[model samples]
Target: MIGRDAELAFLRRVAAEARAGRGGAAVVRREAGIGKSALLEQTARDASGMRVLRVTGLEAEAELPFAALHLLLRPARHLVDGLPWAQQAALRVAFGQGRDEAEDRFLVGLALLTLLSDLAEERPLLCLIDDAQWLDRASAEALGFAARRLGADRIAMILAARDGGNGAEPHLHGVPEVRLAGLARPDCEGLLATVAADLAPEARDRVIEEAEGNPLALIEFAGMLTPKQRAGHLVPLPLHPPQLPVVSRVERSLRDAIRLLPERTQRLLLIAAAEGTGNLDLVLRAAKESGAGLPDLEPAERGHMLRVADGRLRFRHPLVKTAAYREAPLVQRVAVHQAVARALDAEEDADRRAWHLSAAAVGPDEHTGDALAAAGDRARQRGSHASSATAYERAAQLTVSPHRRAARLAAAAEAALGAGQLRRARTAAHRGQRLTDDPPVLARLATVAAMADSELGRAAPAAHTLIDAATGVTASAPGDAAAMLATAADDAWFAGDAWFAGDHAALRRAANLLESLTPRADASLAPVIGTVRLVDGEPAVGLALMRAAVPADDRGAGTIVGTYAVFSALMTGDDDAACALAAARVDRCRERGLIGELPHALQLLTQALGCCSHAERAGSVGIPAHCGPAGRWAMTGVSVGVVRRSTRR
Candidate 1:
């Protein structure tokens, strides 16, 4: 608060606007100990007459899907029943309270927005998220989704995250940001004076310089000084090696403080750090198993290192928890993880228990691997694709059989692709391919890798990979081979479009490949085949096929087939058909809350409108503001630009 007046003022304005039903959000980003958390705390205190919800991300739970979001919304669980049934079911699945079934990730996010808006009906709500960089990918995405769509609602979200390190969070990229910098000279000197007023002039100046405007460092360095050092009778050693980063120096200081604590107190802190959820009962059970008890936590409390409140234990700073876990010996860390795993309720906390067991394993353990694989299945059921990828990756690492490992890696790659982690999907797929020679598994891996590559703009290579994969499986799994060929056609189209505006070489090659396969009576493949034919100079036949594939109902219009049909119509200059199909797709997306598909649908519709010469209608298209960066890009990018160009032509 000392040097953060301007930042605080901005947050105040956000809060004021939200209170007046013009909601907004801001992400506070900075290096460790730059007062991001403190700023949020100060803002919470200043927001009088508002309901406040706070959730801090824990490193130990970073791979657990929706963990932070579950914690943040625990107080509002009663409001879930008020949401639409689809939204209710999505929330229930995400929070692990309902039958295991896949739910759209964006639907879960919309459910969160609705629940929070309901809560804010009584009073303005301030949601503070600290250490957001450590939030699980699913939780971060869900939170970002809700934050971007709080329009006309009495809610203000402020997320604080560490930047410029391995912990950087890219999920919150599009939110308004307030970056904190090192304090100015006068502010640094003032802060140092408050913590080390009696220090000798030279030592005080040295402390200020060494602290480098970090408030935590200023207070901690001063606290570490001896009487002699303070009085100038003896020089204090440098706070840390000059080469160490500021965060490392602070963590080292915190570790030293932990070492000075009683052995039992250190063990208690370790248990708390390992548990991560701060569930005091779970911590106590784990501590009891580890030869520590509730009494041992008193020392840490008195030292202002952590606090126990409302049956939960919380560290004073995220770095304290990090230091407690990292400074411990590997054996001790493993033992704590095992103890925590044992303390978990076998039926209720199986996912967390499986993760802890995996963490505790020192070598290949098939049982642990199986447990993690099951955890991955549960994550996938909840549509937490990033968490599913992490669980499967860990499972693959612990499995002894190469085939099983390959299968797990394949699953990981698939989940990563669903999570939009293109590079991770490609890497996992490549690893899976290297492990297995089975044609089916190889084909699966190749398909995933090619899809990832196509999205990453390697369309030509992607098409080639898909073609080879389809050929390898053509005899045994004709259905899968045909599906791969269909995808290959799409990629080939992209390749041709990207390289030469009107070139048909890639499309011709793909068309020939598809024609060689025995065609099945699958309606889904019609548009894909039609697209190939259109680019292969058979416009009349292509347009007829594409027109036949167009859905007669709105429900089917929100599908991949519908997307391709729209594209084909556009290509063949059937403006009326293209606009109608595209409009239906957008309408279905909005009605069903299919936020993930809305951006693409909007883009296609905008292009269709342009082709139909409805420039005014295209300009006035109702693109959702909550559709994140993708929707914004669709509105401003080539989707709209190409439409304008076509109209001009």
Candidate 2:
């Protein structure tokens, strides 16, 4: 397939080697619709005369009997069926039911393995099992036993499966595994032409992408598309059209498999699909929210999605979710989602909780709405405005009342303000104000609008907006009073109150009033606190305030320390202290790949310590022994400004 040529080649080589009795067997893996079967089929066709044995798996047949290994051993039945009936019956019972006659079954199974072993007396015997994800436990154990005993023998085996399934074959100790994926563009194009010849070259290319390099899906999806969607650009479509879903031949296999799931499992899958990927735990938790006991979901057999080595969980397939969700009645789907939203809301896992609540209610649930709002507030405090906006949007989805929806929208705008996404902020603010008639909220909007300007460094405009918010709104309102004071404090700090020679006394009064009026302490106030003290000629005070707001062991504390260290090095004469602080902050920054703070710290520290200064300080201490870019920049900055180390001049 597309990016799996290397894996296929390696598998074939291993199988051929085992067939030639030159080496041990091999193993391969891949995800759903990744051509695992196709590779095995190709291998089978290529080894037509090599005593090949094939076994296929089925969703319905998995629990019935020894269907899987029996399929693989079917070709050898010429020898198996001829065995003594009593022995055969004993073997059959053993094959299907593990506990019936352990010794007898084991002996019969051993006899069958002996038969296959003898069938390949001189020539190599190759066995291939497809849909190994659903391989029966009995069949799997038999294969494992056979595999274990076939070392250095003229036998090879290949088991193809959807890589991460509950029924996936157990790992083989010596046998290597190869995973399959989608087909190459040309292979896909060829397949497309064979299936649907009317597609123009451009349409053909687009079909290529719609399939996600999945050959089976590409062929199936092309059959259902209307002329309009399939007639254009060769680029990938972000969202599939409602009507033109996967209609390829291979897609039918997956569809049939999903049809067997119970209604509750189907509902569970659909809700999960709406939340997107890597959400198994969330989905399972939310699926239980229906208040319908596990008995109700008995038809929908649930299985834990194991974590892949790459650190992500996957549903058996996206198609399974699509079928399950699309098949769910709309009213039922919405009701279940609402329940899941409530459950997630009750829990404190903000990020995923926001997602579940958003999809579940889609209207209003007080608990879900409140939880989303809290999550949004938390995101803003952490300076992740993007996440804040997302949280606020989820809150909006849970807001049935227009007024509440408007408030949620406004909160999103507030988050956008800190992120400097002015256009987005303005859109949210406008929509919110239009929907709500609350005067206090209008006044708050004015204040937030003003803060937006201040953040962009337009201080004069910022002051005018602040005054408008403080006076234009009701003065007696406590929240407004506190907000206005906070705005005043921000303006005074930005205007450099400590350095303003003309109005030192007046500036201090405004700052003091704002500080006194500050209400409902939250992490959101941490940045503002640090900003004020840093500008008021109190770096130590600013650092202390930030530390108080962010716990010592928290991720945010490192960021606050970093900001203060940089500011101190830049505006004061504390090179050595700055160097040490910056070095620690840089390592933290690099570990998390934090932007904004790391570069600033580096630039500041670099200016305070030049190369000669470093050399002198390093007399024997030598570069802090654990330096980061901040230390290096400090060295460069000092060297350039003092010793003419660069050609900038």
Candidate 3:
């Protein structure tokens, strides 16, 4: 393993903070053969605790196959090993071949996680999944779920991957990265001394210099050297030989793993490596068209055939894939590809449809146009909206018809909007509408653009245009009107100083518009409606109404309970308790990234600050009286205009 004391020190600090009931993340990166795995292993060892679950990357796997996750989190199975048979059976039914299984899996998984957290002796749970680059899409999703669901106090995760040479690895960017560079010269020399003590000083220096202080390289280099700089077992090293390529080592490991698999399995895996997605139906058809036979072997001996529920499956790692794909012959690839095309014709799966369409549409001398469009439609139905958008974008690029391209952009725009991607929605809407003057489409495009600008605090020219569209639309399409109102609110609320600069009539109009659009149900508007009322200079009525609205909910008391406390505490001059309750409320929202509630937090903090100032000695220059200095003193800018932004923007 690569030893870098400094990198380990940083990871330790993060671990320490987590131990002390805080959360932290670390990211690590380096070129191939730079001892990334070595560092990961060391960190994992250091992070050992009562519930340490480890998952490392495999070399060749399908891009996003679901079953690979079964390998990563098999530990979750044992968690149910001791549960009652009925519960276990119910769980099986939940995570198994039925739609309802998803709910059971989640609930049972949550219960198990909670139990584990409570039962663990003293050590915290550390889930380490390494070599994230080759992670299956399902595994990535599981990571997201686990991050939010795992024990808040006892669980932390460690992920490791090689540098993708741009920024950090995309998958690992959400958490922290702990980069693993080359070892220091002293560490390199220390490692060498373990292998061969008292080597010539010149040779040791030469080894360190040649390895660029990379421990693995120095160890491998030292092994291949002689007492002199002459020829040796692996290759004679010069006094100053250049660093050996680690890719070759990675390459050899991959080749060996592939060679060891059964011949039929290897061939199928090799074909899948080239296919990229390795989606079963497509690969199987490719094999059939290529005239490859499925051996009619017995179940016990032919486990590879059913290793995953999906017959045409991916291997576990990208390195395994790179090795096999690099070695496949051209003639074999063409035959398998013919099979793939035939499979696309036969099967009706959505992801496979998109994949096959993508493959055929872009391939040499193939007519990709019509098939690509057909596949794009199927892709959207399969809940692969993002993938469908990609297919449509490619169609836009390859097809010559302006009308067809506009249609493609429209599909892409809808997908973007459904995905909560406002930026992409704005772009696609703008482009698609520009190419088509169809009034309805134009109106839709105008609505999208206006909402996009307004959401980000900019004034838009399309508010009235969208309002016109909403009125023209059918009664069944009230959604359009609702969207337009929300967009207008967003624009007005987020307009900054421009909002305050409106003329008297304009201010009254905007105020009425906001009041009309705000949620009418008292049940929903209790805390926040009262909040705006107080801010609008009617403090007494606002406080009384909010106090009446507070009720005990099973999910914890609603916002009104906390708001009432802050208001009452401020009025009664209980500054310390007021600040404490306000801070706690703010802390809870902050944890949820509830930026919409920040203005409420600010208002409460402002009141608490006022009470504190009133109690302070007159000579003291600290927290001032009134809401002015109080708001600033209590986490300035922490919650400014959050509620106002939602209503006005």
Candidate 4:
């Protein structure tokens, strides 16, 4: 914590504010070995009376959905029972404690928030997440979702993550950040003096200089020195070469330390690292399978590489785990994964076992690929879309058949889209497209790519892609083709007036295609038909269709069709209908714990409120334009100011 007074003060203030019922969160970003974890520990120690919860991300569990969250909330599981039934059920399903798999991902986040708030009702809560960069995508997204909405609750979160390295947590982007740099020269000298008091002054100065103020480097490099080197009788090798980053050097030093341990101990350490969950029993079983035993772990413990407590094993630092796993030969690593997979309960831990099996495989194996694909299905059912994407992608890699590979890639693309990973969805879709010529698979991939493109603001191309996909699917899958046409019309609307003015072809084509579909009086088709009518200059028919689509109750109000109805009402100058529909959407979203939809719902509500002369209330509920889809919609002549002014007249 040396040279971190300012950063400490910021974290302390956040806790203090939360203690006073103003909850907040801060993400601590820094390179490895720069004391991010140390700072988190210090802050936790400083929070005297607060309820503390911690989750340390493990590399082995990075692909397992909700692993980090499961660790963080294990102690607070009892509090979840008091939450609303929807939230409670969501949490149960997410944590694998229930059979119902219809949990919404956002509902899981909401459940976490509620549980944390309940825990903080009696005492302030401090959540410390270390090595957040290694957290699974589902865990990271859920944490971010809850963290962003912390308000008037005695809860504070501080997430420490590595930056400028692999495994960046992009989901945590919107949270407030406290960036850590190297310590100052004076602080580094003082720290070195404490750790290496008897070192020669010249040698100490050289260590301090070479460490570049990185706390781990300072400690580990000094620890590596012999008495002769410390006494200036022998010069230490310059391990911190300019070409290698300090963090890399520190990792190498840790690996070297691990190499000094007994071979059996190293094998035990590798099993522990590969297990990732710190399940002592599982690790021991896996180690025994590799001819290592509990006695071998003593060397690792004495070396300060890892510790065992409460039947669980934990590495001293994330780097220790990384070094242990990476230092092992590939054959040994694969054998460890296979051992761990064997140790897992076949029925209960199928997902983890499948992942390990996939990791252990060196070549195409249809059985393993099928196992991973089933795992992907389970992840998707649990609403862990990112985890589903990873499982499917790995399954695709292990599949020898081109058609199976393409199908898995399509599933991955769709799952990635659900997880809000736009670039990954697009890439997977493109790869799938190149692998398959089947019309159905190609249509699915095209649809996924188009949806991703639309979200990424390539609306014109997205509209064209959707139109083509719909055309390809029309003969075989008329229902899906109609849905695609409807989506194409929505994309054309998202393209805005500028694109509409420049080229009316995409809109005309969408309208023509929808017209060609078998006539149905379904409410789901109202918005698309209304949009087509508007494009064809029949405002009366469009307005009537939009009005018919606006739901009379909450049951239908929380749907995408309802969202389109609100927008259509606004576009057709029906402020009263827009306001009512938008209000209902917001309320339904909150009541159902649909957090992903809430932001856009709130935006629409704010706009509707603004149009109804409740501008002050709108301001209070308003989300920044850039933060929601409303900003893009504003380009289509439905801006707040324009609506407000028109209504005022």
lDDT string for model 3 (245-339, tens) is 55555455455545656666666765676566556665656666445444511221243222335464544334446677665566655555445
Q: What tens-digit string does per-residue lDDT give for candidate 4 at 187-206?
A: 98889878889888878887
- Clash pairs, candidate 1, are none
Task: TM-score for candidate 1, please give it.
Answer: 0.87
Candidate 4 C-alpha error for residue 321, in Å: 2.0
Residues forming the 10-long window of minimal summed lDDT in candidate 3: 640-649
TM-score, one value per model: 0.87, 0.40, 0.54, 0.86
Q: What is the lDDT of residue 503 in candidate 4?
A: 28
When sorted by TM-score, best at the front, the candidate numbers are 1, 4, 3, 2
Candidates' C-alpha lDDT: 0.81, 0.55, 0.51, 0.80
Q: After superposing candidate 3, which stretches have Cα over 4 Å from the reference?
A: 5-24, 42-49, 54-74, 77-123, 133-152, 165-175, 184-269, 275-320, 323-353, 363-408, 414-422, 435-444, 462-482, 489-497, 500-649
**Candidate 1 lDDT:** 0.81
Question: Residue by residue across 356-444, what tens digits does model 1's lDDT show?
Answer: 99889999999999999999998998889999999999999999999989999999999999888899999999999989988988998
Off by over 4 Å in 4: 1-3, 98-104, 165-168, 236-242, 494-503, 519-527, 530-534, 537-587, 599-649
